[model samples]
Target: MSTNLNQRLFNAADSLRSKMDASEYKNYLLGLVFYKYLSDQLLQTVVEQAGELLKEYNSLEKQEKLYRDFLEDESTKADLIQTLKDVINYDIEPDYLFHHLAKQAKQGTFQLNDLHKGFIYLTTNFEQFEGLFDDIDLTSRKLGQDDQQRNITITEVIKQLDEIDVLSHDGDVVGDAYEYLISEFASSAGKKAGEFYTPKMVSKMMARIVTLGEEDRKIFSVYDAAMGSGSLMLNVKDYIKDTRNIKYHGQELNTTTYNLARMNLILHGVDNENMNLNNGDTLNKDWPTDEPYLFDSVLMNPPYSAKWSSDDSFMEDSRFMRYGRLAPKSKADFAFLLHGFYHLKDTGTMAIVLPHGILFRGGAEGAIRQKLLEDGSIYAVIGMPSNLFFGTSIPTTVVILKKNRTDRDVLFIDASNDFEKERNQNKLTEKHLDKIIEAYTDRDFKDKYSYLASFDEIKENDFNLNIPRYVDTFEEEEPVDMAQVGAEIKEIREEQKQLQKELYDTISELTYSKEDEDWIKGALEVFKYED
Candidate 1:
């Protein structure tokens, strides 16, 4: 069933790619898909209530006449819209309905202007309401260079998506389709993928490690500093059952991705008010700057090695001020680390993926590491396999920080070799993730795999957080047997002697026979005497 749905969805997406670029194509197609999802859900609720009303009215003597009258009544239509608004948790006017648009599209009269107006009408009507089509950009470049192209592209995309039942019991089907498109675009977006989309396995590991051994009903708030499409933040919802109790918050720098994040949150059925998507740089200007805000669970896969202004002005910034030095203008890994650390609540746990350089870089980074370790907030550092990301092959580490750690020692798991190699990419399977989580939860110090480094020990190493320095993953060679070695040496000597004899025989035969050996010796002697 998933295969069939995927094929149909892919075909629909492929049909519109010619009119737009792959990256832009995603936004356009996904916006229409989300619109269809909202419309379908709203229509389903209305139809169900309509059916109930018709059943009740059918008990009268003029049952058929009453049903016809109710269907045609304007007040009944208004009530249906009201019920739809209330039940679906969003306002969907009749004109914005997917079936209505599909009908117009099939009749060849649904022009781009009409579709754009419908989308605008949808958002404007619901602007005062709770859940609205806040992310769909009618003027987005993804639609086309101009109105004509954009309309054609959107109309066809909507027509194709309108064929599927996106509001079925398997309602996540629409989200799954959207995720497939996200993964496709992420591959082509290169480093930009890190901004919004985290590898699924990495998100799983973060969510699993943070929620280890705890009941799904445990109330907690999950946040991400760079919540690209809000995938990482939303993945936590799947890991936990009582997600309604958990509030989702995130800040994205890219306007497009910020919009995507909000759309993704709503499409996944997250209450719009519960999920806060902010646009702007998280390090410099925090959008949702509610003082001392902290989360119970934080997971982030920020851009690897991004550059930022570590100028003197930012020295006074609270996120970096406490460190006493700025991260180098060339590398912002530590900057993100400090930000995540600051937002960590006293009872919160945060997991972040960073380049290995953060572990051993000298100067300002070193001082920050020293402070983090000294404060006992650094919980565990697990080394992940290489090529786990979309654009780069560099191995990354997941540093788990906790404000309320039971142990003073930090857990280090050398999971560098724990991955499945498929094609050209390395993936963390369920087993690999489970093992890392087990070691982290149990705080096990397995030989050659994990170690518990104390604060003093880390300080003794001058605060170098390198994994190899703490957990010696090197394996020693086995000792050789002396007696067997000596016997093998003797056998080699005898074999050399026989090989020399055979060589001498072959050379002597090629030059002169044994009978000419004496003659050659006598000639050598005579020549020496003459000299």
Candidate 2:
């Protein structure tokens, strides 16, 4: 039954993709998925409420009448209405729920104007819950060249999503499906994929590392500068059971991706009020001005080698003011690092993925690296293998920074050689992530895997924090076998002489036709006559 349902859902999505691009199809699919989630939640809430009323009237003679009266009570009615409002306020409208949309679609009366109105209704209803549907562009060209085609595509999507019982089934499956769609869209989007998504394994590793040893206590807050699809911030929730204590904060540069981040958070059951997503260039424009704020845990997998403004005006900005020199416009790796570092609380720990260039790049980046190390903020640097991301094949590294540390040494894990290649991409499996995290947690310096470099040693290298300089992952070649090599060379020379004689004989046979029996003699006579 599940297989049949899965096939039907996929087929519907495939048909929609035939009419629209993945980027456009994503809005329809994910928007409907969000719609289904709210509908199921609302239906479930109603059923639960109805069930409680029935239970109360089980022994009453006029049970039906009593139950009806119970539902009509002002307080009960208000509660039900409030519940519907709460769910709708989170991007689902009572009238435009999946079931309702499906019913309308079935009758063939659903029009593009209706769907647009439904979207507007949802946004208007949830205006208090900002950023919920900010990423879903209903009118984007990716959906269709015109409104009619988009409406048809979306109607089909609504019909398909109406079949899923998201609220009744296991929550993880629905969340996983949403995540799967996000990943699929990211892969198709190519370089743009990096704007909104991080591989699940990477997010898991970062979440695990940051939440280590604090399984019992709740993380106070979590933030990501490049939230993308909010996957990294959402991932931290998977590591712990109680997320009520952890508040999520993120800022995204892309409008579409920022909307995705908001949807992703809510799709995973995060309350709209708990997660804050701002759309703007995080480096230049710092949103959410509530300051003196600090997070207990932070994780980021920012774009690699992205260009940013390094104009003299930015020197006066608070994020770069302390650093003295702004990160060069060509490389904003350190700029993100500084932003994350500045936002980190005294007890918070941050792990960010950066291009390997940031480790040894010169000029302003180099100065920033030196100052960070000197301040004892860097904790560990883990080298990830190349081709780990979808767009680029360049190897990357994770720099773990901390506001407080007991040790002055930086732990370097040369995980560049540790991944298992799957198809064209390299993956860090659960076991691999576990091993790396275990080494980090234990602070054990295993040969080839990790190394603990002292502060003085790092200073000797002029504060260059490149992983290879500290983690010695280079393997030594076997000692040379001179006698064996020499014997092999002598035998090769003798074989060469025999091969040369055989070649001469073959050449002479081929060249000597019936008329030219001695080609060498004929050639010599011709040369003498010419002289």
Candidate 3:
């Protein structure tokens, strides 16, 4: 069933591929999908609750009675909507439901103003629905230069999505299909894709690392400073031993992607009560909170080398104060790292994906690196292959951090060679992921693959934690056999000489005109095989 929806949704999305950029069309598709889900949820809720009240009547008549009774009294209608608001956090009238709109569209009776009114109703009353539909502008000429064409195009898209049954109880098909669409959009979105989606494979490995050996405690909290469509936070839940209850806290800068993240959590069945996803700058003005060092695990894949305000004022900030110097203004890599680190619990684990420059850069970044290493907060660094990301081909590294860590040795993993090359990007297969994770878990010292560098050894290199410096992945050239190669060359020359002599003899016996035979013999003589 999931496979069917995945194919259908992707095909539906392609209908608008030529009209607009994928990054733009993605919002329209995802927003409408969310609307359909919420509408179906409301329909199912009303039917179940109303059916119980009319259980005394027969089946067909009971259905009619349920609808009539709910609508007959204005007070009952208000009470029911209030009850729905309490349960689902929002209310959707039957007339404004997706089915109602989709049916009208199919019958050629749908009005663009009708769709506009439904969106207005939701956005006006629910803060969560704000700006989510801004990208799907009915008045945008991109949909069509004329209002009629725009209506037809949008109507067809809605009718297509209305075929999928999002109300089924068969697993999390809705979330899985949404992920498929997001992945497709990311593939075509180029550099902008990284801002909204981290490849699932990378997120899964980081999730496993953070939740590796933890027991099923009563409460577990996960944070991604740059949440990116909530893929990373949702993925961490998959690796936990017991996820009866988990809290997701994240801040994202982009508004459209932020809305996508919220929708993703809701469709994955995460209640609004359990999540605190924010749409704001994580670095400039972090969501204010009194609880620092409260998260059990922190994960981040912020834009590499993004610029930030580097005033000396940040020196007083709790996240950057301990690092001695702020991360360079031009490169906020360490700033994001430190922010997540500060919010981490003493027993928490943190993993971040950053460019390789953070390992050996000089000046301000270097000083911060030295201080972190000396504090023994650095746990392990795994070097990954180049071109693993969507847009960039530069190799990246995953640096894991642990607070109050007992070990003073830094584990260096050279997994840069362990990847399968796809068309445009390198990918970590399950086998590759397993090998890297095993090495990380055991802290094994495999020759040329991993090394445990003592704190003193790292200090000797001025606190440089480059993979090649600690774990030499370079292989020595095999000793060459000069005599063997010389003998083979000699044998080949002798064989060529014999073959040339045979050709000369054969040509001497051939019939030809006198001038042609002379030219043939001359040509044969010039083909001498030098020994």
Per-residue lDDT, model 1, residue 456, is 80
Ranking by lDDT: 3, 1, 2
Candidates' C-alpha lDDT:
0.72, 0.72, 0.80
How does model 2 fare in lDDT? 0.72
Q: What lDDT tens digits, residue by residue, belong to model 1 across residues 1-531? A: 556556656777776666566666666666676777676665445546666553444322233233344547887856655675676666554555666777677777676666666677666676422233444566766667887766666677667777765655253554466556655554553445545666778888898876664446567688888887777777777667787776888988877677767767776777756766667898776445683267777888899889998889988877788778888888999888888777877877789999999989998888888777877889999998888776678999999998756665788999999889866567889898788877887787888889988878888888888999988877788898999999999999778767666655555455667898897666544433210
Model 1 regions more than 4 Å off: 50-72, 103-109, 128-151, 163-165, 168-179, 182-187, 213-219, 239-241, 404-407, 475-531
Give per-model TM-scores.
0.79, 0.79, 0.83
Better of 2 and 3 by TM-score: 3
lDDT of 3 by residue, 206-290 (tens): 9889987764766788998898778787887777666657888988998877888888888776776678888898888655375
Runs in model 3 deviating more than 4 A are: 1-3, 46-83, 165-188, 241-244, 476-531
Best by TM-score: 3
Worst 10 residues of 1 by lDDT: 58-67
Q: How many Å off is the CA of 104 in candidate 1?
A: 4.3
